[model samples]
Target: MHASITAAGQAGPRLPPVRNLRATTTQAPVSQTVVLEWEAPEPGLAMDHYVVYGAALSDFSPSQATLKVRVPWTTHLHSGLPADGRTWHYRVVGVDAAGRVSRFRGSTQVSVTTASRGLPRIPAGNLVATATSAQQPDYAAEFVLDGDPATFWHSQYDPRVPMPHALTVDMGEVRPVTALTYLPRQDGEHGGTVTAYAVALSTDGSTFTPATTGHWWALDTEGTFATWPATRARYVRLEVLAGYRGHASAAEIGLFEPPA
Candidate 1:
């Protein structure tokens, strides 16, 4: 007797199809510096670039949107924005080389404010500079003087000297200073070296102790530049160690202080 086996088989279990999901944006609450981030869709899918959209919350929508320039990654930092007390809306999308675009992933809102305006206010203070002399023939070539006579160095050279000279300004009282800016001598050949410069703290302008010391280099032909620091000082001094070869020239000086 020949026996044949009848074909009897059951269908395999059906599985769900993989969905093409959009990416999402992960950003912190509104701040001066906004950090926008997102995640990849799948393990093997490559993201070629990202597009960021931002607008005022009042006007933000899918059809009406402001697009930032496309970036190469999923994260970006938007900084130095105006603190106008307005809420901003942001969204991100991912793009691939195969002309495939991921759905919008992340959304956020942020607020901005001026760093100085937000700080506490301090009592009004006086800025004084004392000088020994106050006479110069070439006013155009010499540094402009703007300080109290008791504490600042005054140029006193008579008109006989055609070349203008440099002057020192003693910042009176120890106060916090965030930035110091100065103009270099105009005559390129008269490039002088700053022998010693310091931010000092003084109860009285006459007595000054160096609080901070900085190395001085030759200024470029450009008019002026600035130095920034994290700490504050009461007084600042720039001593002339050497002068340029040609007629001397100097310009105004300024100091920037953060709010109390």
Candidate 2:
């Protein structure tokens, strides 16, 4: 390889960087793990080491290092990563036999989600009413975030109060929201469960673009969470498209960052 490189008139001791670093999931009947794979760097470069840098959403900084792992340049797979239902970011770099590091290559911001990380809920934010019903005025929207799951907000039963009832929340400032969890009435009955809903995001609370849409079963007493790609926004609107048992109620609404 050295003779060929010299013959080709290339002069460099620094090895070429790795390319296409990614995580591939594999199952083995009873358990599963992630396999980080990559394409070898350009030929003729005598690579001695390969390094991987990774980060999670909560403490990641592109400008500074977070975590590091190194291996020999002879192999391409980094296996046995636990599947804990978390999203991860990764990159790769190469080093020459002389210990000089090559320029980083492949995706510097490649993101992956592992199977073991469950839906991670962050702190809830300020709640506000966008549309309200006048029928059940005592069961107001403010009751949802007041920290009591026993109490709930039920849209008015009046025909004029509108069908797809909604409530918008402001996070106090712009933030990257990755998942949302909606708690049901929590009384073990489907008196006012959200059957189908659409969620929207906005920066100024005036304009919104739909982000996620899904349904919940009347028997989903524990509630369910829906996730979307991480998006930066200050306001979130949960539009209840359908209701069960003639009441539109929520015990709690949670916002979460993408799992680590």
Candidate 3:
């Protein structure tokens, strides 16, 4: 017999697919740009677009999302949502290019609360190394948390480097964080930019998990951001999934308080 080890202790020391299918509550960020990514609702449906519905009532249906947007395929970057700082429930549905709505494969409902922070924003400081997990960039990662909007953490301009550059950030200690704002390089050029990405939270720097897998919107705007359910953790990892221009960069990162 071979005894093995893995990183599966964050979600209360158990994996997903609990017997209970009760609604789960998540906190949205104070920022309007929110990323909603989920496992395929149903496989082999040839889903064309994904629609999200958000409302104060948990009973709200996908048709009553009040604020609905069709993402490209299976994920969406719900931008411009009003930051009312209230609890909102979101439901996702798939629609084929032929205008056919597909059925969800399984439970696909999540409760998310908008950022409700009354105090000012807090700086997480420089805690991420330049190269982490498998990335070892020659440039220093300290440029990311230096609180300088003019500076940025840059990776070697290697378009050949397997993308989705993953950078694990440490918060010094465990703290309740609700939102993360990514300030793309405000410089005129756009070679080193992260267009799409996701984040995972961790209490220990080694073992990290996302409250729920979330999509970081494309770095179109100079100072775009994403807010999810507030979580207590000492580390956060940003995985650049797609749209890597030439390198991965960040002008500034803001870790918000419990959006209460």
- Candidate that scores best on lDDT: 2
- Give the clashing pairs for model 2: 83-116, 84-116, 84-117, 85-116, 85-117, 86-117, 122-256
lDDT of 2 by residue, 225-253 (tens): 66678899988888888888656777666
| Alpha carbon RMSD to native, model 3 | 16.8
Candidate 3 on 105-181: residue-level lDDT in tens? 24456766555345235555435544442223434567667665556666655444655577667777888876666
Give per-residue CA lDDT, model 1, range 1-260, as digits (tens): 00110110112321121133232323322114445665555555676665566543333433222455467766666653322232345665555555455544233333322232332222224444433334433342123443211122223434333333334344455556554444443322333433334444444545655545454345432223233443445555544334343223344444555544
Give lDDT: candidate 2, residue 95.
60
Q: How many backbone clashes does candidate 1 have?
A: 27
User: How many residue pairs clash (N, CA or C atoms closer than 3 angstroms) in each of the candidate models, in the order given?
Assistant: 27, 7, 7
Badly placed stretches (over 4 Å) of model 3 are: 1-29, 32-120, 125-130, 133-139, 158-160, 212-219
RMSD per prediction, one decimal?
20.2, 18.9, 16.8
Candidate 1 accuracy as TM-score: 0.34
TM-score of each prediction: 0.34, 0.50, 0.50
* Residue 197 CA displacement from its true place in model 2, Å: 0.8
